[model samples]
Target: MAGIFVYAETKEGEFRKATGEILSRCRGVADATGEPLVAVVVGPAPEDAPRRLAPFGADLVLHVEGPGLEVYTSQGYAWAVTSCLAGRQPAALFFGNTPLARDLAPRVAERMDAALHADCTGLAWEDGRFVFTRPLYGGKLLARAVSRPGHPVLATFRPNSLGVAEVAATSPAYERVQVEVPAGSVASVVKETIRQVAGRVSLQEAEIIVSGGRGVGGPEGFRVIEELADVLGAAVGASRAAVDAGWISYDHQVGQTGKAVSPNLYIACGISGAIQHLAGMSSARCIVAINKDPDAYIFKVADYGIVGDLFQVVPALTAELREMLVRA
Candidate 1:
């Protein structure tokens, strides 16, 4: 039987949601092609990744133990992954379309000279070949790409392209592989690995997010956004303008230069949507936009919209939601 390799990502000794999603997707690919799903998690052996990958359908967990690998480096990670691929030569390789994957996938593809596809929304096996569906022309069109003339066809899937990882059978077997990572200078030197700043959240992982932009007025105005987020049990996000205005942290900024998110619900307050910002979050399941301008681009994608002053609309919305929750 063929095999499909998955790069299970981890942070602070825990598996990221992307890892679970990739493993789940690979389960389908494995069942369809009758290939075993092999997950390679490069980090310390004591990490929680091996245990985490099991329920998602990993048949064999390749634990690549190495020094300083707990911290991510493009060169080190690619070397370790490609080296493992050299031995297994799987039918295809899958990764999450995150910043790390964005940085690492292309490097591995270049090393393996394998066919590569990015931002895939759907994946399937057709005619004994791997086919991928991805958005093109700024989400205006969808294009299909097939692994043309390649072994170990490489694909990176967008986060939230698949749903939450469901429960499965327990305790898949794990194999620890000792890999000697050749030293390199390209690794990201860690000046500091601080957690989330005083305000703002990891938009990519949030279930709900309240984002603010220039229309938010000022740094003080973000307080209202935070209050709304608190009431909704949501995270706080920001537009580039808000970050540029020093109203919020850069990590919370949602745009091309910032994080891409696909939350269950995304609420944009006082933001005039830019293409870059929309590109990051257009995939959200539901969106609510509040802005004074009736012609704001954010309204285009919003599931619900309020064409009124955000200052007035947001407080009223928050108060109403709070009262409704209390009543319930």
Candidate 2:
């Protein structure tokens, strides 16, 4: 029987939020196609890994473990995943559009000779085929694609587009798949790993974001943005102008050149909302802008606008949020 396969990505032996998001979304596709949902997890199998996936609608969890597989090596992972798909012959394979997936998906697709789509934002069924919607030209246009019948479909989706899955009452069956890394398959060895932000939520996976721009003044000005972000449990972001001025790191930048995000709530502080900046965040479910210029371009996309100094407004808002949380 044909099935829908999902790659369950993990970090530090724990499942990433993207794993549950993709699994939940694939479960719906599997139901529509009348196919079983299968999830393949690679790395050192944590004791609870299989259990964690069952609730997300995994009919079977393939736990792939082996030496040199503990850390992410593109060749090793691709080989293992391709081996699992050899016999099952899934109708479609889903992956989160993450750094790891970007590297591994292409290799697996080449091995399976399957059609590949990247950074998809939506999925649907039409004429017995799966339709994948993805952004192009830096999100200026959206393109839809479908795979030919008799060939397995492969695609990766952006984070946060599909919400996390609710837990199911029944548990999924577990299977162990062992991998043997062929000679010359793994060319690089990871001697060390440097993690960024020990436990902070990844920017792409954040449900809410608080961003700043040149009007934030300087490096010290980000303290205000951070304060508000901490209060709201949101990730911090900056406009390209702020990064260009050396006020913040490039990783915090949000624009066409930076990471694209679609959070539930996006609060822009002192940002002028250049088209480049807007491209990265225009998909936000709700936007609130704070700028001294009432005619700022940001107001065009903002659901709510506040004309004032962010310095004063941010502090006051943070204070109110803290008080409300305490009262609750």
Candidate 3:
């Protein structure tokens, strides 16, 4: 069958936020092309997974279940996705530009001899072609690309870069495809998975982020940042300088060398906002910078700037937000 296929990524048995973001974007393309929206899942099926995908406009869900699939192995996931493509070809295959997708999408495209585009922030069907837009030169520019005709197009989207559709009560139809892992196909075994236990939101998936930098002083300084983030239900982020100083773990770092995030609201506390740092979060919908230095480069890109010591300002703001939230 000719349709649109989306790789629904999951983490620890729950759907990743990127799954809904990609599906919502693909839904528009499917509607335009007059094709069914097929969501493919490779792993132990989560209860009500298909029903959850329906709200994002998945007309059908293809569940691929098999041994050696519970933990993500590049080879195993690639093989399973290719197996689902055996009897049918999709107009375009979509995957989130996540770590797993980064490894699996290229492999699947290579197996199918299809064209692939990575880190696409925008996708559109124009003039009978699927045009994908992705950032280049550290997000200094956006480049548009399209695949050759007569080949299945493949693309991976950055998380939170696209919008998510509202949830619906209706459930999509489901189909189960049993995959047989070929001998010698499975190479690595996942011994253990250590999950990060922190704020409610994952940095990549967070809508609001409160980030600190070297100006925060020391490890103890992060408490203020965390308190503000907690009150706002935002994720805690750190500049590369903070991580390098050992004030926080590298996982909290956000810069060219670290994670790129595009949250709805990015509160940069005490960050000088170097070009490298901006490269990672310049795409945020709104940027708020709090720094004592009015000359801080971060203020240049901030939608709102507050010149003050973050220590006092952050606590005051957190207290105000708490009171307002309580009153509401």
Separately for all candidates shown, the number of backbone clashes (residues 3 or more apart, or on different chains) is 0, 0, 0
Candidate 2 residues lying further than 4 Å off, grouped into runs, are: 165-167
Q: Can you write out model 2's per-residue Cα lDDT over 145-213, one digit (the tens) per residue?
A: 987777898999888876775746347788898877787879889899987655556777789999999
- Candidates 1 and 3 compared by lDDT, better number: 3
- Answer with 1 or 3, whichever has the higher TM-score: 3
On lDDT, the candidate that comes out on top is 3
Model 3 gets an lDDT of 0.87
On the 0 to 100 scale, the lDDT of residue 271 in model 3 is: 99
Model 2's TM-score against the true structure: 0.93
Which candidate number would show the highest TM-score if scored against the true structure? 3
Off by over 4 Å in 1: 45-48, 165-167, 184-188, 198-201, 323-328
List, residue by residue over 5-105, the lDDT tens digit for candidate 3: 99998887788888888777777677777888888999976878887887788888999998778778989989999988887978788898777898999
Ranked by lDDT, the better of candidates 2 and 3 is 3
> For model 3, where is the 10-residue window of minimal lDDT?
162-171
Ranking by TM-score: 3, 2, 1
Name the regions of candidate 3 deviating beyond 4 angstroms: 166-170
Native RMSD of candidate 2 (Å): 1.9
